[model samples]
Target: MTVQTWTFVIVGLTFALYILIAIWAKAASTKDFYVAGGGVSPLANGMATAADWMSAASFISMAGLISFMGYDGAVYLMGWTGGYVLLALLLAPYLRKFGKFTVPDFIGDRYYSNIARTVAVICAIIVSFTYVAGQMRGVGVVFARFLEVPVETGVYIGMIMVLFYATLGGMKGITYTQVAQYCILIFAFMVPAFFISFQLTGNMLPQLGFGGKVADGTYLLDKLDGLHRELGFAAYTEGSKSMIDVFAITLALMVGTAGLPHVIVRFFTVKKVSDARKSAGWALLFIAILYTTAPAIATFARTNLIQTVSEQPYASVPEWFSNWEETGLIVFEDKNDDGVIQYVGNQEKNELTIDRDIMVLANPEIANLPGWIIALVAAGGLAAALSTAAGLLLVISASISHDLIKKQIKPDISEKGELLWARIGSVLAVVVAGYFGINPPGFVAAVVALAFGLAAASFFPAIILGIFDKRMNKEGAVAGMVVGILLMLFYMMKFKLGLFGGGTKEEWWFGISPEGFGSIAMLINFIISFGISRFYPAPPEDVQEMVESIRYPRGAGAATHH
Candidate 1:
């Protein structure tokens, strides 16, 4: 079968499976909508959490970034994986014990202030939207290639599909669907790796294959480094980023992972605090399977791309090249009117332009893998993007409907009314998400990294202080979050988004890239929070007691609304 035909079959089947699961697990009450009725087993929640955590950033873009960025890309690997550990160990159990459906719910009740809750709601909406933009873009990228549709049309399709399941079954549907997604994505991710690994180094395990000898009896990394040097690029094994930037980016991603609202809300779906902890462990294990394989895939893809394209005649290039070229991701200009390709690193001599996002998607084709394998990757990419998009959309809707409308503006609203409002909010969010998808600010991993920075800057400080500091008051938490998020927005706009007339890399604040500036902003938030807290009265006595109560171990109990 042709790759497109296989894609239609696999992708169509997976989509049908997701829709069926959503129908089977449809939510009938507020609890079901919010936290899947808080009865999910640890194993199921763990698989669902892994699917939610991976995102398009992990399944599609992480390895692609690594393939192009080489050594510097390790920052993403370290930051994201390290961040998950931080979240599981430091935040998940306590937040589960607090028994809240959303981050704002915890912030509001713990701080004993509706105003604080409102601020948290705004932060949640902003962060979730920024993250979902990357997911939507991932969806568009896959469809544009496999389905041969315009990226705009792909975004619209993704928006409609996500809206159907996300709004209809809410978290109840998303959780079960994610479990199935995890299986498909993991299978899709690994099969190609295994095939390519054996083809290159006679090893079925990709993790070891990249380190093993290639056909010429040289280590894969050593050969890549040789290729890079020959092409006037830096050695593949050496990093170009400064130490401070790497450290800052890693810290930012770690704290940001802990602060992400959609990921945190998964912990609330479990039955008890202990269950949350158990699920966290299970999730980390499941996540490691792909994380370990990514570097190998990146290495293999980079080597294959260079070997297959560089110096090859335009007419003689593989069929995969022409297919991707039609999508405009691969451009061959035939510089100097020579028949041979010039894929050198130097801009002046380079004749081939490749988008880094295409490396993973294009890998199986480049290596001449079977058609079914290529199609399976397309389905995996969609599964990864849709699963996380659903999760983020749910957070956006819950922030508005549960945190803002029910808790503040219309405290007397009935459960059914709130559910209706939540669905309305989800629909609105999908429209906005689709817009960002069509007008994406950057590539998938880059956009996602910025969202992590935003999460780190805005939510990390407030949540940590709210949980651990008994004296933390609403005035300080609210002020800190506003300042932190604004500071992050300013930096991202000026540097990342190229606002404020756009500055050069040399002009970055204290030599930090916008992606790493979150660490500085988070530090300042901690400072501002502490500095202002001394002037205000401590939290109310009962609030402080609630904080203390959350700190201790307790019997396993269902998540609560109080």
Candidate 2:
């Protein structure tokens, strides 16, 4: 069968499986909608969390980032995974012990103020919506390429799928469907990697293949290092960033991962504090599978891409090259009128811009793999993007309906009415996100970094202080969020938007890129929170007792009051 035909068959089967699972596990109540009735097994929750966490960024854009950034990409790998360690060790068990349905619930009760919860809801909406916009864009890209449809149409298709499961089954249905997505996405990711590894290094595992010798009997790392130097770029394995910048970016990602409300809420689905811990470990294990493979895929794809295009005439480049070129992802400037493509860095001060988002989707083609593999990869990318978009939309909906509308504005609202508002919130969230995806304000990867920074700055300190420090009050949480978010905005606009008469690296107030500025913002938030918290009288005595209650697993059953 042709590549298109096979892709339709495989992808169709996967979609059918998702619908069946959603139908089988449809949620029946608000509890079911919010926490999957808190009956999900640790293993199942781990799988669902893996799907929720990976997103389009992991499945589609990561390898591409590594392909060009080289060692700098390691920061993402280390930062994102290491954040999970923090979550498992310090946050997950305690949050689960607190036994609330959402992150805002914990903050609201722990601080003894509904206003604090309102701030959390606002922050969660911002973070989730920013992140989901990228996923929606990713869905559009995948559909346009593989399904042979316009990008907008692809996003609409994704929206319908998400609405079907997320609205009907709620968390219950979404969790089960996510498990299926995890399976399909992982298999699709690893199989092509294995084949490419064998073809390049005679190794079945891509990780070892990355470090192994290539066809010329030279280490791949050494070859890449040489190429980078020859092309006026930094060495492939060494970083050009200052130690402070590196530390800042890593810290931001760690705190940001711990702060993400969507990730935190997943622990609530597990039955016990211990189960939450186990689930975190399992989630990390699942994430590591993809994390480790991503760099290898980057190396393999970059090398193959250079070799394929370096000596070939631009006009005679393969059909695949032309197809991607049409998308404006891959460009060649035929400098010097040599006809042969030059893969070197710009020597004439003219740079060719290639979108990093294309690395994974274009990898199979670069390696001359069968067309079916390419199509399967496209489908897998859609699954990754859509699954994450759905999760983010749910968080956005819950923040507005559960936290804002019902909890704060109208506490007496009927449960049925609240659920209806939640669905409305979901639709609005999807529309806004779809619009942003179709017309992004900036680069996809850059927008993602901003979202992480915002989450790190505004939410991480509040959540951490709320759980660990009984003295933290509503004033502290609110002030911290306000200051942190404002600082992040100022820093981002300074460098990213050139709002302050254009930004220069040398003029950076602290030599931190906007990407790495979150750590400083988070630190400022923590310091301000602690300073003000010491002066303020402290949370109510009952709230202190709540903190104590959340510290142990024995009394967790009673932590849920409703």
Candidate 2 lDDT tens digits, 113-162: 88888888888888888788888888877777666677788778887878
* Candidate 1 error regions (>4 Å): 556-561
Tens-digit lDDT track of model 1 for 344-373: 989999998898888889999999999999
TM-score of each: 0.99, 0.96
Please count the clashing residue pairs in each candidate, in the order shown.
Answer: 0, 0
Full-model lDDT, candidate 1: 0.93
Clashing pairs in 2: none
Error of 2 at 24 (Å): 2.5
Give residue 408's lDDT in candidate 2 (0 to 100): 89
Off by over 4 Å in 2: 333-338, 347-352, 555-562
